[model samples]
Target: MRTSRARFWAAVALAAATVPSGLACIWDGDTLAAEVRHRGYLVLDALTGRFDRLPPEYYRKRYELASERIAKDPSALAAYDNAAVACERLGRTDEAIDWMLKKQAAMEALPVHDRAARDDARYRFHANIGTFYAHRWVAGGAKRDDPDALAALDHLTKCMAINPEAHFGREVVQLGMIEWLNSERKQSLGDHLAERVMSSVPYAMDSSNNVLAEGLAGLVLLGAAWESVDVYNCMAHTLNFSFDSSLSFVAALRVEELLQSGKRPLDQSEGWRITLDDAASFWEDQYKKRYRTELTKVYSQLRAAGDEYVRKRNEYVLARLAEGRHPDSDGGFWSDWTEPARVELPDRRALTRSQFALVQTLLAGGILAGVVILILVASRVSRSRKRAR
Candidate 1:
């Protein structure tokens, strides 16, 4: 009997232990606290390179496990959110988006009062989506008008509207907006929007304080400002013979050439020198002085690329000019001059036109007056000669 009582008590202890696990900890308030703590720990681990403390490829495996767990539970939105955030840091944007979407769906299933955290998570997810779109747009140039970019823009805008700084959404939206403005064909709109983007840059940079993010922001601002210089050249009377866009374009082109040619800062200056005439010369100087050596290298490369692009464009322009074609306001060199060539009127036609008629009449009057004077002179001379004889 005593042995039976001992086994019963042991079984009760085991059941009590399992009760904590079986009671569905999803509704537990303490679960969120643990989740936050786990996130902090993961962040710490990532920072300290504590890979040994975590499993090999902990970020990847953890996300996978979290995804599996959420798939089974469907109510584990908090866990999924945490995993999605970690995935983002790991540069797994697609996986992150998936997890975030699940989190959003789970959040919507919850009550209004319980939705704040989930909504914030959604903001972050959308921001990353925007970033993905921006990168794609930059990569594809004129060809990135796909559904992904459109969806990214839509999500980012909604995220921004919900919470501007939520998950650093504003920066994502602003960066995407800058890319859009930069690629736009309308010069005036591009310039105005780019200026606004540059103006808001400091705020966005400060919000994240991410080095790469800030560096990109700086680069973008520099590009926009340089492009603005191009627009100024388009309208400036002083640059009628030499477009300012050429200067900017060349500066950017050289940077690109350097990057593509695998040339370094100390490489041969074969049409690759950063000269005073470069559109981003001043900006490059600032970077050289302000940034670290590595960062300076990146900035220099970007500057060179921008300059090289401009140079190639200018060379193309000069080539077209050799073919008697001209660079147009729409950023293209064309042989077709829209305006008609000037033509001079024939003397017969000149006699019929109003202004030409006036001139002709005056000329006729002058010739007649000359004839009368000559006749008078000859008659006077003839009379003088007869009297003398």
Candidate 2:
């Protein structure tokens, strides 16, 4: 590290001192201040902590350094951005928001002649707000009704509208909206909305610092299609078991048609369509084969309980009818099957526990293998370096 730092500083000095025809200092005061501020940031981080964890002092120093840089270079966009991110990383949500808002305010204060700069700044403002809202939503204190979740969606939408192909922001916003919709129990609406958003995804779209738009668009479309299948599956399961109405055949046919379709939408996302077909096939196979046992059990249990309730209801009605009174409007069987209707909903947690356990075991094993491989590779690299020296 010392050797590398010495060499880096040597290069920096050479660049700073060199001039073709006595041109003034290459790095002006603002640039020098920016360089010093970056070094201070590195030193602050070292003094505070290491990767994956940071003491409050680390963040405090980082924020102070960035703030100083912003003060020196009032148009320093990165300084404000870094300060805002550092504040968020330090768990200072309000401070982060304030810094970001100030960054936007400063950019807006710039002259109207700089229209392009203003536009860029406006995009950043909406994008950062969208990012913050998404983080808050995932952090889970905010419920479905939380205005922050809505605000996040709104910000992201605005960002995309400002620059319709902001692949990165659009992807995050779409995912956030999907999650928010799921949390709000508006799964159907989410599915349809996701479908629309995905349909408009640019094929070669590349987000800054990432190649995610195409891949994520594929995933979102596939997920929405499968979600549609799941909705029908659930409906079929409910009707088949609860009401003795057979909708599985119809649902299966619809899912099959979707899987088999070679229409424009499906052709547009062939990569995703293949995976979607696999899921649909899996569900359809379950319906054709495995569904019988589960549906049979559920139906038998429900039907038996329902029959008992009906029997008691009929008995009560007949007894009433036999009495010197009519069993019509006043003595209907509506009051009879209350007990069966009150049966608790199946506990999804309990139902999924075994599957969750299996997934956890697989994940733990995979992580352990990864750690061992990383250690071996690191050791091999260390030995190679030593030999080279």
- Candidate 1's C-alpha lDDT? 0.39
Clashes of 1: 21
TM-score of each: 0.37, 0.37
- Cα error of candidate 1 at position 355, Å: 63
Q: Compared with the true structure, what per-residue lDDT tens digits does model 1 show for residues 229-298?
A: 2222211211111122222233334344444566443212133233323332223455533323343354
Cand. 2 Cα-lDDT: 0.42
Instruction: Name the regions of candidate 2 deviating beyond 4 angstroms.
Output: 1-62, 167-179, 186-193, 202-389
TM-score of 2: 0.37
Q: Lowest summed-lDDT stretch of 10 residues in model 2?
A: 20-29
